[model samples]
Target: MTAAEDVTVVPANEASWDDVAAVFGTTDYPGRCQCQRFKVAGWIWRDSTQEQRTAMLRAQTACGEPGAATSGLVAYVGGEPAGWVAVEPRIAYPKLRGTRVPWTGRSEDKDDDGVWAVTCFAVRKGFRGRGLTYPLARATIGFARERGARALEAYPMITQPGKEITWGELHVGARQVFADAGFEEVGHPTPRRVLMRIELSIVD
Candidate 1:
């Protein structure tokens, strides 16, 4: 069992791009999608090539440049890259603005830069089921709050006990993970997905 103390979370810009790639290995949907599902303006599978998506991820992460803007956080277990979570201003995800899930029951400004969103989470193969995302999710609260985000939100899929969910389906994260991180459910747009958020007090 991987203890909570074994994990260290850092902004993507502070990590190496190679470490980030290692977390999103080659065989899984994470590798192909490269966390670009909601990043692209159109349908990801049809509009972007794998190479294009990979390039986009690398550029967005700005890995190795601490002074640059980053789109997410990377987690290391015992100094090995083990997980990643994409959190950025909601407007940064053009495709998500068009999706009905976030807009279903709430009247939110689609272009609110103060409102940040946690879009995806990818855990390395060997690190799966170790509860690494809990800390990663918790880290985003401070990461976003310090950066001026008035709120941090996540659209997570609901998971039930004994009902196995594929990694692909849980990439956005399981509802409980965010809930454990102090996020409150603000919207239930679909039967299987709930929008979770934590209203943060922006730091000066």
Candidate 2:
């Protein structure tokens, strides 16, 4: 297990834009993604330029400006930004439209913004495998629960022992982290990805 003290997870709204940027780094991979995969879809996704995507991230994550909050939480290790987790109401992510997992085995009002969702996670180069995801996941619950979220959901990958999966595959996060955070598996649209959810009232 990684030392819990090594990192600090704060609501994105509370973190400075520069700090969040550091966690995401100045690289093309993260720069291009702009944490907007779920915010855009199909033709628009293909046509949208990086600049447009970046702006979308700025608007959604609420970076830089005071009172502006990212849709996720930023993680810092000993004061250095180390990671991020993108979470918000399901409606905030446009790409989720018509997604199979969220619709399978469950009937939910798709328009309900009270239902928050955990979509993505990013741990900086050296911060991986330090149990950062779990704390981030735990912190998300606190963040959402305090904000009056009725429920929170996550889509995570199921990794098997000795099976090496690429970082991209685990970007949504691992199942163990959600389980540790008290989210129960409610649906499985894909063998590798399971839909996990926890009602805020059940936390206690």
Candidate 3:
């Protein structure tokens, strides 16, 4: 078995589609989602078929093609797939543009593609509580900056002890998780959700 301390993250495109699929698994929210929640929006998202979401994720990841631009990152522990996180330009998430959770109190241009976002995460069942999200979140900073991102954002739940947030709801991440990665809570869009961000450009 791969030790948690050996976790190594790499761009999803650098990994094979099968490895990515292994992280996503075969049941529950992560399996059904394939991390496409933010890619499709509104009725389209509700109406889209599972097969469609899977195909979209496959193409989006561009797995097996090392040179293709990937939409997320994957983590491996001792050569075994362990986790996945979707990090890409904010503009790449179509559902986020029309959403209110990320912009409730902030005055910012919604069209900036240079602004990146961590939209989703999936940790393999056996690897839960191994602190995989920390490195995944930290990696987005350099990944986006290297790709010309001016800012990086995440919508994380404000988890409290004794609170039982469903795995599906917490898939975006938790407040403390991103905070540990150096993100600041800029907007409290809801009682349970917070909009956290890190500014690379210092413009907003």
Candidate 4:
């Protein structure tokens, strides 16, 4: 397991595109989706080509530009790109507006830009099972708070102890990951999914 001290998190824009791609790899859902699942409208696989999705991710991340806006955070373990977490204003994800998961029992405005969401997490093949998501999840709190978000939310899957979940199903992260990061459960939209959130008090 990589020590927490060996993990470093940075805004996606500050990391190079190569590092981002390294985390996404070329096979798996993360590779094919490229974190554009929520960014695109309609069924992602039907609406966008692989190349188009990749391009969209690149533009959203704005990799290699420190001053540009970024939509996520990248984690480096021992100086190698190991993971990524997609976080940005909830308004940035158009698909969420039409999705039922985030709005089942909640009566909040769907267009709230002050609310941010952690939509996906991807850990590089060689770096899995090392608790990288903990730091990545922890990082989103300050990342969103510092960016002026009123609150940060995540829709994570509920995991069972003996049940084996595919990486594709857990890409949004397991519920405990966000809970450990100080997120409180706000809603349970499905039998297997929970909406967790942390309210942030922005300081001027």
Best candidate, lDDT: 4
Please give the CA lDDT of all the candidate structures: 0.92, 0.82, 0.87, 0.93
Q: Residues 72-123, candidate 1: write the lDDT tens digits.
A: 9999999999999999999999888778999998889998999999999999
lDDT of 2 by residue, 42-141 (tens): 6545467878876776677776554654598898888888889998888888778667878787778889989999998888877778888988999999
- Each candidate: RMSD: 1.6, 1.8, 2.5, 1.6
TM-score of each: 0.96, 0.92, 0.93, 0.96
Backbone clash tally (model 1): 0
Residue pairs clashing in model 4 are none
Q: Write the per-residue lDDT of candidate 4 for residues 56-152, one digit (tens) a residue.
A: 9999999999998899999998899999999999999888888788999889999899999999999999999999999999999999998899899
Candidates 3 and 4 compared: the better one by TM-score is 4
**1 versus 3: better TM-score goes to:** 1
Estimate candidate 3's RMSD in Å.
2.5
- Cα-based lDDT at residue 160, candidate 1: 95
Per-residue lDDT tens digits for candidate 3, residues 24-68, read 997889988778787765554646678888899999999988888
Query: In angstroms, how far off is 62's CA in candidate 2?
Result: 1.9
Per-residue lDDT for 137 in model 2?
A: 92
